[model samples]
Target: MSKVTILGGSGAVGSIATETLASSGVFSEITVADINFAAARKLVGKLKGAKLSVAELDAENPHSIRRAIGGSAVVLNCVGPFYKHGPTIMKAVIEAGINYVDVCDDFDATEKLLAMDDKAKKAGVSALIGMGSSPGVANVLVRFCADSLLDQVEAVDIYHAHGGEKIEGAAVVKHRIHSMKVDIPMFLDGKFTTVNLFEDSGKALEEETEFKDVGTYSVYGYPHPETITLPKYLKGVKRVTNLGLVLPPAYAELIKGMVRLDITDEKPIEVQGHKVIPLEFAVAYILSQREKLMKEAGINQPMGCLKIVVKGYKDGGKNTYIFSMSSRGQGMGEGTGIPAAIGAILMGTGKITEKGVLPPEACVNPMDLL
Candidate 1:
C-alpha cells in the first residue's frame, strides 16, 4: 500500500498536513507519527479518508525517524524549529531510501541539507526541503519571475506577515526565537552575506509594508532559506531578501524585549534549586501576553500574505512585477501546511524527477506548483 508518514503529525502544521495529504488520495494509508503517540492517534481518528494510523517517533533519534518512515512511499516532515531536526530527519529519509518533503525554512539547516546532495543521490531518493510558505512558495515565485517574467532578474524582495493562529506550539515559538537570535542570510550585490536580527545589519533593511487582506505592519529581516537558495538558481540576481513578521506589534516587541534582557539564552539555569532554560521561560512569558497583543492590534482572524517584488530590465527597459498571495481566515496551518502536502503529493506521485536533496526553487517548476 502507498503510505506517507508525517513526523510531528500531532502539532499545528503536522495536523493540517495530515488532513491535506489524506484528502489527496495519493496514499492508501497515512501514518501520523509524533513523539506523542496518543496525540497522533487523536489526529488520525478524526480523518475519514485514507486509512490512518499512529506511530510514536522521537525525532532526535535517527533510528526512530528511520523506523517510523521505514516503509512509507513518502515522508513529510512537519516538525519545526527546523534548525533542530531538519538535517537529521532528511538524513534518515535518505537512509531509509524513501522520497521526502519538509517545511524547513532555516537558512543554516537548508545549507546543511543541500550539502547532503551526494548522499541522497547515492540512496536514489528524492528529497525536497524548504517546502513551506516563505521558503517553499516564495522560492517558486522568484523562480517564476526569473524564468518567465524577466530576461534579466536584478532583484527580488520577499515580504510576509502572518498571525492569529489562535494557539502556537512550542516548536513554532522556539523557531521564531532562533530566527531572531541567529545570523540571517541575504543575497546582496550578487553575493551572500549574514546579518543578525537585532543588529544594525538587519535593522537597516527593516521596513513597513502593507499585505493584501492583512493590515500593514513592520517587518524585519527573517532568516528564511529563500534568501540563500534563490540566488544560486536565479543568476545575475543582484539581491534577494526575506523580511517577515508574526503580526501584532506588541508580540514582536515582547520578543524583542526578551532579546534585550538577555533572557533568550538556551542554557539551563538553576532557579531556587530548580532547573529552567531562560529561552523556555521567555517563550512562556510571550505566550501569556500574545492574546492581549493580538486584541490590541485588532487582528482576531487568521491573516497572512506572501508578497514578492521583482525588478529587472526587460527589452533593455526597466520593469517590475509585484506578485502577492494573501490568505484570509487562515494562518500558518493553511499557508504552510497545504504546500507541504502538495510537495509530498508531487513526490509520492513520482512527479519530482530530481534524485537528491534540493530546495524548491532548484528542482521544482514554479508554474506547476503555482
Candidate 2:
C-alpha cells in the first residue's frame, strides 16, 4: 500500500492536493498533517476509500516532521512561506528516507534545497521542488518545448496571474512583498542579470503576451525559480523571464503601497507599547480587508492564467509554441495544489525515477501533468 503524507495538509493548497491525490485512487492511505490538528481532521473527514489520518506537525521542528512522515512513501509539503519551513522539512524528509515534493516558490530557499541534491541522491530519494502552477507547469512546458518542439531555443517567457479573492496566509503575503523589494536573478542579453519586480532593467520587451482567454495585462518582471533553473536545464537559452500580476488595480495598488513603505521588514517596532512587525501588521490589515476587497472587485469566482512561450527552431525552421492553461472557481489552491499532488503521486509511484533535488521542469513529463 502506498502511503502519502501532506505537511500543511489543512491549508488551501494542501486540501486541494489531498482531494486530488486521494480521488485518483493511487495512494492506499493519505495522512493529513498540520499544526492545526482539528483542521486536518476536518479535511480528512471528507475523503473516502483511502484511509485518512490526521496528525500534528510543526514544520519548523525536524524531529516533529520526521515523526509525521514516518512510513510514508511520499511527503507533499504545502507549507509556506517556504523560505522558513522548506529547508527544515526537506532535511527531515531526507533523514526519514522518503521521497519529497513541495510547492515552494521561494527562490533562495530553492537554491538551498538544490544544494542538497548530492545528499538526496546519496540517500536515494527524489526531492522535486516548486511543483506549483507557475513554477511547476511553466517549467514542464519549457522542457517539453526544448525536448520536442524547439531546437536551440533562444528565449522563453512565462506569464502568470491570479484574479479573485486572495486567500493566502500571512507568510505568503510577506514573501510576495519581500520578492518585490529584492533584486531577483534573470537571464537577459545572454547573461544573468539582477532585476527588481517592478524596476525596469533597461530591457525592452513586447507590449504584451496574449493569454488565451484572459485579456492581456502589462507583465512586470518577477523573479520565479524558472528564471534561474531553466538555463541549467535548457542549454543555449539566452533569456528567461517570469512575469506575474494580480487582478484588480486596487490589489496591485495595495501591494505597491506595501512595497513602497517597506512594510515587509521583519524587525519589530513598538506600536502603542506593543512590539509588532510592520509586515505582520500589513498582512493582518490586508487579510482583514480581504472580504471587502473581494466585494469591491466583484470577484466571487477566482481565476488564474499561466502561459508559456518558447521560441526557436524546430523541424529545420523557426517555430514558436505557446502552451497555456486557464482555470476558474478553484482559485490558487486548485491551480497550484493539483500539480503539486501530481508531483507527489509521480514520486510515490517511482515514475520520477531520479534521485536528487530537482525542479519540476527537470522531473515532470509535461504531457502527463497536463
Relative to the true structure, candidate 2 has a C-alpha RMSD (angstroms) of 1.7
Q: Write the per-residue lDDT of candidate 1 for residues 1-370, one digit (tens) a residue.
A: 4999999888888888999988888889999999988888878888888988888999899988877887798999999888999889998888889998999988888889999999999999899998988889888887887888789999999999898996688888888888888888899988999988878898999998989998788899998888888887887889999999887777878887887788999899999999999999999989988888889988888888999999998889989999888987998888889999989988887779899989898788876687
TM-score of 1: 0.97
**What tens digits encode model 2's per-residue C-alpha lDDT throughout 169-236?**
77667767767777777898678888655556623442465665566777666667888899999888
Error of 2 at 70 (Å): 1.1
How do all models score by TM-score? Answer: 0.97, 0.95
User: lDDT score, residue 35, model 1?
Assistant: 91
